[model samples]
Target: MTDFQTAARAATVAMRDVFPATPLLRNAHLSDRFDADIWLKREDLSPVRSYKLRGAFNAMRKRPEVPLYVCASAGNHAQGVAFMCRHFGVNGVIFMPVTTPQQKIQKTRMFGGDAVEIRLTGDYFDDTLRAAQTYCAETKGYFLSPFDDEDVIEGQASVAVEIEEQLGRLPDHIIIPVGGGGLSAGAISYFGNGTQYSFVEPLGGACLRAALKAGRPVKLDKVNTFADGAAVGQIGARTFARLRDVGLANALTIPEDRLCTTMLDMLNVEGIVLEPAGALAVDALKDLGQSIRGRTVVCVTSGGNFDFERLPEVKERAQRFSGVKKYFILRLPQRPGALKDFLGLLGPEDDIARFEYLKKSARNFGSVLIGIETTDAANFATFFAKLDTNGFTYQDITDDEVLAQFLI
Candidate 1:
């Protein structure tokens, strides 16, 4: 066995001391839908509800001589490290971006208890990482990198180890979620050339794809924080070094909105509550299409740290992506029977979700903001056709992010 495989196997065995291996369950719903023997590696079921715990435990255990551990994360990694710190009875100072969800922050505290002190700084993970490293330097604490450390990579490879053991055979394909690249790098190291791998990243923060295209890791100009767990401006250099040989062929980027639909589907249909990042692998299954049919495929659902507060946002995005919900701004004539005429355009399935009218006294027309949700996506086409046929003037603002921030 290669050195990495050897270390990863050892990590897998050591992880039993902390928590049992997360389940590798046959997802009948996905299997039937895709015509494949689909399995979900339930990393979301881990003690921290993320595969990050494996890496954090392995990395911290190796440095027992050190009295303290430090790290930065958006959420999952922080929880992982905090859980490990409590497990090992070691002092941990976790640095997290201020934007991290309250659910995660509270959980990390609950896990670490009094053993860990959390400092919230930075607007992104990279900035949080820098602050952590600086604190580590001054305090002489062992800084646990979320993904960049070699030991963490080996630890994360335990996921691959459990998969092979649980399945009793190699899967034809493994679809993995990519954020900082630690888990993907570790899996690649453990599996070698025996299996096909698909790396799925949030479209707004596809650092792995960007790195493959540039032949080096580069910071993205901007990152959408919707998929908070998997959204990072840059991929880890150490993780990228391991992932370099894979190229971009197997990498898939799922749009943030499109991914929301998958999240809602998994929740409503399968009763699986997957966070935005955790659903990355499942969302890629749609794009895999014919390639995975009749074959055994594994999707690593990375984390289930979804806060209930985000449910409305998730539903909104899912509706928009499905084309069944729309927002529009229209110029309605300020005349008798005008409002009634506009109401006549609605089909039986159409429901008005929002209607706000702003009147301009100097003008003959009033600006009206409307949100419509219909039973079928095709209903929008018919609705638009009627609007065009009539004299009503409107602008579709569902996709207009600028106006959405201000009006919708």
Candidate 2:
């Protein structure tokens, strides 16, 4: 075993004093869907509902003399550090973005109790991270990075150690979610050449993939924060150093909207709760297709910190991705029977989910915003063809992100 792997195994053993190993359970639904023996490393069931606690615990445990610990995270990392603060009975300050979810903020507080102080700083994480670092430097407190530190990587590697012990042997493939690369790096160090690995990232925040392309860590010009847990704008330098050798072929990026569809499917069909980042590994299975068929694959379900309030948006995105929902701008003639004639063309499966009349741009033509839902994708094709044959002028706005953002 490599020296890193040795440290990872030791971290796994040390973690037994904190929490039991997360389960690696075979998932029948995924196995049936992919024609593979699919298993889920249920990191979502960890103490802080994330694998982050492992890194937090390991990093803190190694430095008992560092009485004051500081960190910057508005989501899982903050909660992880807070939980560790309470666990180690140490003084810590957690910096969080002001726009962080109330649920996360409350949970961090609950976990830390009086052991940690919560600092709500800038609206963006980058701004908050800088603030935390400056404060730590000035106060002589140790800054605990979310992924860049060696100790954290050692801690995250515990995931791989547990998998090897529980599964008896390495699986053919392991799918892991990538944010800053700590978990992926740790796993790679632990498993080495024993297992094939696939790194899953949100398309909007594919920092690791971008870094691989650049041959070094590079910041993204813009980041979509929909998958906030995994939406890191830049790959951490130290973490990327460990992951720089990862082949671009092993990285997969899933669209944020498409990830929402997977989240909904897992929820409704499998009764599984997955946040956007948590669903990354499972969602990438579709892209792998036949390559992994009949093989044993383990997908790490990284976190389940999804707020129930986002369910409506999740359902909307899922329906949209499935083609069961659509939005269009219909050019309606300003004449009698026009509305009735349009309604008569509807198929049996089609239902008007939304209808609105915008102010007319012309005296003879009135613009109408319409949203339709159908039982099948084929139904929309037939509906569109019928509209074409009848000389209906309409623009499909379902895919117009900019316009949809403003109007939908």
Candidate 3:
């Protein structure tokens, strides 16, 4: 075996003393839908609800004498490290962005118990990471990188180890979510040229794809933080080195909104709860439809620490992406029966989710903001036809990101 495979095997054996291997279960629903044998490597079911724990456990075990540990993360990684710190009886200081969800912060604290100190720092993860590193250097504590360290990469390869043993053989295809590239690198190293691989990334934070295009890791101009767990602006240097040769065609970018639809489908149909990042692999299946048919495919559901409080927002995005929901600003004549005329344009399945006059003081015309939800995406075609036939002046603001952020 190659050196990485040997190290990864050792990590896998060591991990058994910490937590049992996460399940590799055949997903019958997905198999039936795609006409393929589909399996889910349930990293989401890990003790920390993420494959992150494997890296944390392995990294810490390799540094048994370190009195203190420090790291920064928005959620999953922090929880993983905190859980490891508590288990290893080592003091840990975790820094998180101020805007991190309260649910994650609380869970991190619970996992660390008395062994970890939580520090709410920086508005962004970069700033928080800098602060954590600086503190670690000043205090002479071991800094645990979320995905950059060699030990962490080897630890993450344990996922591939479990998959191979559980499946009895390598899968025909494996889809993995990429954020900082740690998981993808580890898995790629473990499997080498033995299996087909695809890397799925959130469109707003596709650092791996950007790196492949540029031939080096580069920071994204901006990243949508909806998939907090996987929305990394830059791929880690060490990870990028390992993933540099990944085929460009095999890298898939999933839109953040379309990802919401997958998240909802897994929840509603299969009764699986997945965070935005966790659903990345499953969502990529749509892009691999013909290639995967009759083939055995494995999708790594990376994490399930979804806060239920975001359910409404998830549903809203799913509806919008599916084309059944839209927001528009209408220019209506301020006259008697004008409101009645617009109401008459509505179809039976079209429901008004929001309606408000932009400027109620207008005398001749009033700007009205309206949100419509329908039963079918095709229904919007008919609805728009009626608007055009009536000569109504309106602008669909659903896709107007700037305006939607301010007005919606």
CA lDDT, every model vs. true structure: 0.93, 0.93, 0.95
Give the C-alpha miss distance for residue 240 in model 1, angstroms.
0.8
Question: After superposition on all CA atoms, what RMSD does each candidate show versus the true structure?
Answer: 1.1, 1.4, 0.8
Candidate 2 ranges beyond 4 A from true positions: 360-362
Worst 10 residues of 2 by lDDT: 357-366
Model 3: per-residue Cα lDDT at residue 262: 95
| Cα lDDT of model 3 by residue, 41-96, tens digit | 99999998999999999999989999999999989999999999999999999999
Best by TM-score: 3
Summing lDDT over every window of 10 consecutive residues in candidate 3, give the lowest-scoring window.
Answer: 242-251
Q: Write the per-residue lDDT of candidate 1 for residues 22-128, one digit (tens) a residue.
A: 99999999999999999999999998899999999899888889899988876888899999999999999999889877888899999999999999999877788
Runs with alpha carbons beyond 4 Å of true place in candidate 1: 359-362
Q: After superposition, how far is residue 266 of candidate 1 from its true place, in Å?
A: 0.8
Q: Write the per-residue lDDT of candidate 2 for residues 63-122, one digit (tens) a residue.
A: 999999999998999999999999999999999999988999999999999999999999
Whole-model lDDT, model 1: 0.93
